[model samples]
Target chain A: MFSSMTISQLRTLLRAREVSAEEVVISVFDQIDKVEGDIEAYVTLCRSEALVQAKRADALLKEGNAPDLCGIPIAIKDNISTAGLKTTCASRILDDYVPPFDATVVTKLKEAGVVIVGKTNLDEFALGSSTENSQFHVTRNPWDRSRVPGGSSGGSAAAVAAGEAIAALGSDTGGSIRQPAAFCGIVGLKPTYGLVSRYGLIPAAPSLDHVGPLTRDVRDAALVLQAIAGWDGKDPTSVQKELPNYEAVLSEDITGLVVGLPKELLDNELDPEAKEAIFGVANVLESLGARVEAISLPHAEYAMASFYLIASAEISSSLACFDGVRLGKRYGEAKDTTSMFMKTRGQLGIEAKRRILVGTAILQEDNYTTYFVKAQKVRTKIREDFQQAFGRCDVILSPTTPTPAFTLGHKLDRPVIMYKSDVYTSLANLAGIPALSVPCGYTEGGLPLGMQIMGKPFDEATVLKVGHLYEQQTASERRLPQKEVKANG
Target chain B: MELSLKEMEELALIARLYLTEEEKKILPQQISSILDMVHSLETVDTEDVEPTIYPITGSGVLREDEILPSLAVKDALANGPDIVDGYFRVPRIIEEEYES
Candidate 1:
């Protein structure tokens, strides 16, 4: 089906005039209409807007004045701003707040002539691992109707997996992209922090925030990354280095590449199936002439705690702007300034409130040195651990998440349990290294299993190379989850 | 150490959040447990360790001060709940603040 074709395939078809840009876009919207009731992937869909953009893209494609992603329909996580689109971040506070400017990545995507389908749902402010925290609605895993498509990028991942969009963009602070990509059985890359401009991405935790692509395959991820990764003067933290041609790296051989298996990540704590899947990928790499070895990263045990404390502290600082002042839905009668501000912020979701409160507590006068400073110091140790490990291996391999998608609402009440979902994935964010989750296989329950590959800073080429190689070598084709809902006649 | 209700309330105030009575009742335990989960970080010896703030090694750049067009007043006021005279109008702290 046109909807199931990868960006590269669709690009070839469009360039060859076998399928028009409008046809692909229309198929995508039709697919979205057929499946959206079952999987609530998007919060705001730009139907008419996308049709207009598709017409423009068709013109560009016909003129041969377009890039590889020209005429492709892609979804943006709600947190990424598109000018005049309501970028809610899946929170009520910004429900009606349309952005005046497109994010740097959005601008780049438009320049490439890609059609944006709409804003996908996310954990409110991209705070949770599950879209259950989204104020609008919960996005379900296409693999299992009752299960969560791992989040805070669950909507983006779900949309791509369900053929709602050919590919989508999601921002990862702590496994927001990778984990959901795993859950949805697709390719998700978290580029090295600062590789992508964060100018218009609503910040969850700036220090850890990264915007990357979620695609059905590794090559498509590379295509999207090529378009989006670059420095922007608007984002001072953006890397000033020259962009790598990710597409070129995909064709490179993996012979003699040393893949590291962190001993800590493979310990008895992992799900048996996930552990086997990682080892299975190792075997595939081994057959491909790549060597896999066990490596130690001792400080990784402290990653989850360090990430939460550090991320929460940064989130507290970044979210300080949404006090019904600059742009957000205001609540209650205007009493006094303090009360109005308090009531306005009272509209924040429970998860947002939890982070804000804990984050505020950590930054308090008495706790700053104890919690915030200590976490920052641990962060240095975590980065050092990766530095030392990468000294011996080209890339590290592990299960992207500890387990496949957990049943919906399983860990909702237990904040600690929910936080554990990102334990294996957050280490990359801590070290500011690049990581990608590629579908390894599936568990017995038919849910997706993900294999994670980590590379040294600015070495996304190697990471994508390894993932692309594995994706190419694996003989198994992805088994799409059986659809549970059918369109009414 | 688990936080008491008073401590949680203090945090809520610091966070500028207004919690419901049920939230006030449940949040202390929740926040206390999360704090407890992070308490394990103290076991790590971080003495004399320099904190890493920005992970990238490069120093911040100083851009040349150049004049650029700013956001249009209409776009700026587009999402505002209340606007007056091309500015976001908030509850008056002092009448002279918005007197134009």
Candidate 2:
């Protein structure tokens, strides 16, 4: 019932009594049961509870005072706490942990009557550029099962791409959300750092993390963003802006809009085909009356070093809470307290240990300024570079990732190479600007390629307007992998 | 690429991970590759730029410094495997100097 419909279409059908919320819910689970074994996109599926929520949504509609998101099923990234749901962040450490309170995003979604479908999988603790770091199971790219959907938001991206849910929530700390969305060919946004409330997101890094929307279409992403964007006393950093008029912004014309293409975004490292597809997108935009221009963001290339030094240093300290003390799974049996703490973290995956160790080292006396603080200074320069570019452009456009999705386990022996895959997406996060990844085209292998649009800080409306325009031109680029597979019994 | 075995041990100790000797052997290459990336930032002129530490700027988010109650001892111990006398119990820590 829902495979071809947009969220707007589904809402219309639901309100018109053309379809029941229960039917849409059943259709989604049928798809999940059909493809999830190979996709591994969902970490926990609460089928019984989801049906109950769907039923409740239907009842509220019947009563005729339904919430804005009534009957829409959405996936929650496992890292976003949902009061009683087991949110493991795809890590062994958080394996059985469930939060006592819902994250602000989840609470807001529920308040708007969006049915919680299930918890999506991710790289453990939202580290790693690929979902291979997940302790439970790696999420396979829906476009090609052998490939990875870029992560640490891979499961949320893959699930939305594969149509397991209408939309999903994913977090970005240094490109987690946008990279996966780009890899999976969906619309995903990482709001300006303080634009969305971060009250319940498990901290991978305190300052860089952002919670945003992932949807099959730009309109749905904007719709979800509208429902959740606001300041909260619970999240001190959340900006107290008026709830965004995202839907109104969707109609804003692209005519005469000034768009910048950074030299770094079109660098020599970008694959020829990827560059062509992105430039092709720019051409289409120009044809629609938007002016495309080239501008230089000199510090753009150094964003990764800046991201790692600052983010990992914070990760080292933020994760110190899991000393087998307050939260997370406990460790090896031993008589002494110190050994238990040691053994517990020892049980964490190799990737986690590496990050924690690197984080600690960067914060050490000799390396703190020479490495970490210098990186922070570079970050300031990058932010200024963006601020200067915004003076010449309404938005910045680029290929979201340098290349398309790569084969899974292709990066196991060489982890740093995987981190480089996020180069294009991380800078927007570091500069604390809103960025969106929209599906642009399919590679010859049937994998999707995406283009990213970044806008001024807290100006998500501008990003949404540009993405909505881009998505309109590339409407038929929507992808589905299940047509080639048999349904589960 | 020049991380000594001793430096890796010290780093691992500070990171709270217990790295085996084999893992320590692999450290220099990993650290070196990362430092290779860091070297690029060294050339950039950030002379007048103040460090952008926090993404969100705020001068004062001060609260009334009143003490707030925390979770009870039982709730605190809820996730612990072994505990005694209101403290999590673990093996005695070793006093080491990374064999310096």
TM-score per model over all chains: 0.97, 0.94
| Model 2 bad stretches (over 4 Å) | A481-489, B20-22, B58-77, B83-100
Give a tens-digit lDDT track for model 2, residues A369-407: 888889889989989999899999999999899999999
- Model 1, B1-100: lDDT tens digits are 6889998888787778889888888888999899899998989998889998988775255567899999988888888887788878778786565746
Estimate, for each residue in A1-489, the C-alpha lDDT of model 1 and write its tens digit.
788789999999999988888999999999888888889999999999899998998888889768879999999999999998899999989988899999999999999889999899999999999999999899988878889999999999999998999999999999999999999998999998788999999999998999999998999999999999987888888877877789997898989999999999987878999999988999999998899999999998999999999999999889999988778888998767777788999998889999999899999899999999999999999999999999999999999999899999999999999999999999999999999999999888778899999999999999999998888888466666424334431
* Chain B TM-score, one value per candidate, order as shown: 0.79, 0.67
Which window of 10 residues has the lowest lDDT sum in candidate 1 chain A?
A480-489
Which lDDT values do the candidates have, in the order given?
0.91, 0.84
Q: After superposition, how far is residue A360 of candidate 1 from its true place, in Å?
A: 0.7
In model 2, state the lDDT of residue B40: 85
State each candidate's clash count. 0, 8
